[model samples]
Target: MSRYVVSFMKDVLGGNGRQIEVCQKTLEIDASSEGEATELAKQKFCKVEHLCEWSLHADRIQIKSADFTS
Candidate 1:
């Protein structure tokens, strides 16, 4: 299994009147691949936020590997 960081982001107007992506929440998940991590994160995120779907709260989802090496 690999660790992954899943970030939920939403687009909103900034102070400068420009659209910007804001991170609403982030979760760390362990899965076999990026795709698996994404699905797992989505389910967990929706359940935690009490939403029927992930998109209901977040505009987009980002997934990245969390493993680091020297």
Candidate 2:
């Protein structure tokens, strides 16, 4: 298994009135492939009840997968 960085992105206007992609959450997953890593991320990474910041600024949640095969 290899390491993968899975990120959940949120596009929102910052305090400066500029749109930026904010990483709501990120996880390092040890999986074989990108697809597997993404699946693992989705299954394991979930929002906590107390963590409402992600939900508030996120218009949409997008998952990104990057493999660390080195």
Candidate 3:
């Protein structure tokens, strides 16, 4: 079992057509392989751009890169 940080950008309901947004969050997951992690993230977010392994320090996971999507 390992923690991961999933960061992604998407358009949410707002004014002026579609607005670009960013979402970064930490998740605690357990799986037999990385493939399972990917699948879990996909199922949770449904539109995740990047899902990377993360280290849990206290109660926060530092975000590495969250500029891949926009």
Candidate 4:
């Protein structure tokens, strides 16, 4: 298994169709492949994001990218 960093982001749309990110969280996970790590991270994201007071719709939240670090 390899270590990966999954970046979770909240869509912050600025002027002129530019996307900004005001909120983000990175999760370190160990998985056999990037796909598996992405899935696991998404699951974690859902559980963690809901604990906050902010209302983050599914559309507003996304896994920006997942990178294998090790």
lDDT for each candidate structure? 0.94, 0.65, 0.43, 0.64
**Residue 56, candidate 2: C-alpha displacement in angstroms:** 9.1
* lDDT tens digits by residue: candidate 4, 12-69: 7788789877556777878888788877877777688764332453333333334535
Which residues of candidate 3, in runs, are more than 4 Å off? Answer: 11-21, 24-26, 47-70
Q: Is candidate 1 or candidate 4 better by TM-score?
A: 1
Candidate 2 overall Cα lDDT vs. reference? Answer: 0.65
What ordering of candidates by TM-score runs from best to worst? 1, 2, 4, 3
Better of 1 and 2 by TM-score: 1
Write candidate 2's Cα lDDT for 1-70 as tens digits: 7777877777878899999888777777888887888776666655432443444534444444554345
Measured against the true structure, the TM-scores of the candidates, in listed sequence, are 0.90, 0.63, 0.33, 0.58
The C-alpha stretches of model 2 lying farther than 4 A from their native spots are 47-70
Worst 10 residues of 3 by lDDT: 54-63
Tens-digit lDDT track for model 1 on 1-70? Answer: 8999999999999999999999989999999999999999999998899998999888999988999977
Model 4 error, position 70 (Å): 10
CA RMSD of all predictions: 1.2, 4.1, 12.3, 5.0
Better candidate number, 1 or 2, judged by lDDT: 1
